[model samples]
Target: MDRLHRQVGAVGLAAAAVLPGLSAQVDQHAAEVRDLLGVRGRRPTLTALASYTDGLLDGATGRGWQPPQHDLVGWAGADGVAVRLLALCALVTSAVA
Candidate 1:
């Protein structure tokens, strides 16, 4: 593989390794926020998910999140997760509408 491919592969591996953990954390955060805000749903609407993710980004939830220590090459932060979540929300919102 070329340098770029190698780098991409490494990042992909890292993401694959961390995804389960990240998913668990995201789930926990969403559940806590939902409970706090009295949101009643197993599956939240895209708008509500976006709103909760906005709370995560804006610190409205008053909780701090730190990604795992295994260096995601600048993708290792709560902001990264929030951005990805927002993208997911947008994707789903567009698909649903």
Candidate 2:
């Protein structure tokens, strides 16, 4: 869990920095992550991760991305649950990139 957490945080930071062009995709990925968090089970986590991966793939192959609006450090620190989901987002972005 610790390893996964750290990896997610690190990748999330990178994703937030470099994947802004994929903002629309990121939005869906973020939503999925948030929704998954509402449930309790490993399956939900896996599903959210899968959705994020799909979003990243779509983002990469779709079109141009915009610049990210928030600073990585500041954004992640803003809210607890959000931060976690974003961390997972970061991981997915990095993995796909």
Candidate 3:
């Protein structure tokens, strides 16, 4: 039990140390995505995109349709597309901050 605890502690420390680098990478990627979408430096555009995607998800849920578990990126249909777009908006906003 003691050895297991130490192993877990070490793993946690390692993860903690890596998190900042991971965050920076994510922010960089988000900036790239925002640029590709032509929303860079345009807060209004990003906000509108987020709102539209949110509405799409809400509308689908209102109709009692289930989003596919394996297609969170929207490869399957409308549900996934909305999720992916919303995520992109979120990433862009986070990067901007």
Candidate 4:
């Protein structure tokens, strides 16, 4: 495999590894957010996290998101809550770094 392929494989593996944990965190966050906002089941937390994390990994490795979603904020948004948390982590890390 090429360098890019290896890196991609690694990122995919890392994302997969943390997916469950990230989903759990996102679920917690979503629950709180929803409760605060007085909404129910409003966010597709797990899927969004995975999608966002994938997007971040791609961005960090100099690859753009492929087949980007038409709507990433709402119901038709990205998949996997782990991905979403990755993006959030990136944003926070960048802000603090």
* Candidate with best TM-score: 1
Model 2 per-residue lDDT tens digits across residues 5-96:
35344555565555553334445555566575564322345555766545654664376532234445444433334344454655454445
Q: Is candidate 2 or candidate 4 better by lDDT?
A: 2
lDDT to native, each model: 0.46, 0.49, 0.44, 0.41
Candidate 2 — worst ten consecutive residues by lDDT sum?
65-74
Question: Whole-model lDDT for model 1 versus the true structure?
Answer: 0.46
| Candidate 1 residue-wise lDDT, 35-81, digit = tens | 65576464456566556555654563356654223345433344545
TM-score of each: 0.37, 0.29, 0.32, 0.27
Tens-digit lDDT track of model 3 for 1-97? 2232232223322332345543344346455556766778754364555554457557866988553333222222333333343345445444457
TM-score of 4: 0.27
Pairs in clash, predicted candidate 2: 11-90, 12-90, 21-65, 21-66
**90 in model 1: Cα distance from truth in Å?**
10
Query: TM-score order of candidates, best first?
Result: 1, 3, 2, 4
Lowest lDDT sum, 10 consecutive residues, model 1, at 1-10
Q: How do the residues 9-61 of candidate 4 rate in per-residue lDDT, one tens digit apiece?
A: 23433453456654454446445544644445544343443454455557754
* Alpha-carbon runs more than 4 Å astray in model 2: 36-97
